[model samples]
Target: MKAWALLGAPKNQWPSNIKAKLLAAKKSKDLIIGVDRGALLLEELGLTADLAVGDFDSLQKDELERIESKVSDIRYSLPEKDLTDSELIMRCAFCDYQVSHLAILGATGGRLDHFMSNLLMVLKPEFNPFAEKIELIDQQNSIKFYNAGKHTIYQIPDYNYFGVVTLTAVQHLNIAGAKYSLADFNGDYPISFSSNEFLSEKKPLELSLKKGTVAVIQSKDIDRFQNI
Candidate 1:
């Protein structure tokens, strides 16, 4: 799949391991974009961005100029808008560029509202076609959305735990190859199964659903000493 990576404005710095993964993706010809202050972060990390987007609200004039100097394509939005900067970039990537997959970094560490909005954006009706292709990555978690279908989830060696949560009403859901297995289960609002581990390192986790959308998360447990 042709992948695109977007850098969003987050409160904390990205960890080195995640940065390395993004660097590899960039090297493999993934279109990279920086959203507002994220452009500065990309510059600092020595990464090349195809474009820098969003209103220069969070940055000073000089900072925006620096980004402009580094990135050739710059897109500006009105200060007041219905869509967030990240959402605007998403629209551009999916609609304009028509990329098959997207990996979003620096999305989780900002304001609670913004983080939640970023996470829920994939659930939007307009984004349904790209739902399975979008992923939100942070230091501790990699979040992916899926529609009603059978899914095979591979174990991430870096992450110890996995979670599956229903974003909407789910019917005839089955899960296997996990420490706790579920079959033909139905979930209503706010239903989540957390802290599940893979049954085998080589075998993948299997999930099937007849209806509704869900988020699959591979995460490192902060409470655990080994990962922390």
Candidate 2:
């Protein structure tokens, strides 16, 4: 089964159509797991989370009580635990629930450290096996992880730009069906092939890699100043 995890990033950073996205997931019977303040967001949207997981340091007594009342299954963690709330929820989704695919929302655009942590957590030995099964999504971007392999990436609508970023030293990288294709590229360190676009939305973008973990980020231009 698929699962969708809602993390506790800033509300302003949430996708404008977050409700619609969640509704679609709900329609597809995807398990919804809310992390910390993300549970509150679900409540505010008149939806109940399938499970709630977090230390909930950001919540007050009443807010925690409210979530407790709404969600049937809640997992509490110590605030001083070694794992971050994001990692906790991810582990729960993958290990406990054994979800095939986990789509994470509200993981970006708030507290650069937290965003970075979420992005890099999949690199851990424990999570690396499931890297390609996880995706981080926000208003302006959708980021998918990959291990060394030939992969086909279908375009996500409204995302005009596509990028391939190496999280580690990558070898024999090739990109096709893009505005700017790469052939037999190798890098000793993390690098980004950014600002590429799909040659045709109908055709899938092809990527091949011999070694390393990679992140495919599809994004749309947004007015940085408008929300600030």
Candidate 3:
């Protein structure tokens, strides 16, 4: 699948882990789009976007002009619009590029409001069916959703941690090949099952579902909670 990864410059610049993911995506000819200040981040990294989108609100006049002059492809959304730059990225990805999937970076690890909005934006019903294609990756984790099915989890190099979070109420959710195994495990809302590890070094992990949706997050970044 031809993937498009969007990087949003939300106050802070991209983290090392997130940068690696973007570079990895670029290797596969994944189209990269930047929103607002994110475009500047892309420029700072010596990377130019396939297309630049969103209002020029976050940048100075000189910066905006420089970007506009250099980037021939762009979609400038009005500042009066209801959608955020991140939303603009989603719109272009689905409505324009018609991409099967997208990976979004720099949406996390900043202002709480911006982070939450970028995250919850993917949960909209119009995009829910293709939610599998959208992921919000950061320094600490890579997260995405699965509606209801059996999925073979691929191994990401250096990804040593995982967690199962019930977005809605779920029953009969079975997770295999983990430090804490489960069978028909009922996960309640607001309850994030955390700090789990893969047990089998040979096979891929399997998650079987019975009802509702499950959000899985995997990470190789060391937990800051235990960084002593």
Best by TM-score: 2
Candidate 3 lDDT at 82 equals 80
Instruction: Give the range where candidate 1 is weakest over 10 consecutive residues by summed lDDT.
Output: 7-16
Candidate number that wins on lDDT, 1 or 2: 2
Give per-candidate clash totals: 0, 0, 0
lDDT of 2 by residue, 1-228 (tens): 899888888877788888988988888888998888889888887778999988888989999999998799999988788888778877888888899999999887788998999999988888899999998988888999999899999998778899999998889999998999999989999888899999767888999999989999999988879777
Looking at candidate 1, what is the lDDT of residue 155?
82
Ranking by TM-score: 2, 1, 3
User: Which residue pairs of candidate 3 clash?
Assistant: none
- What's each prediction's TM-score? 0.90, 0.94, 0.83
Q: What's the lDDT of the predicted structure labeled candidate 2?
A: 0.89
Q: Given candidate 1, what's the lDDT at residue 129?
A: 72
Candidate 2 lDDT trough over 10 residues, lowest sum = 82-91
lDDT of 3 at 121: 68
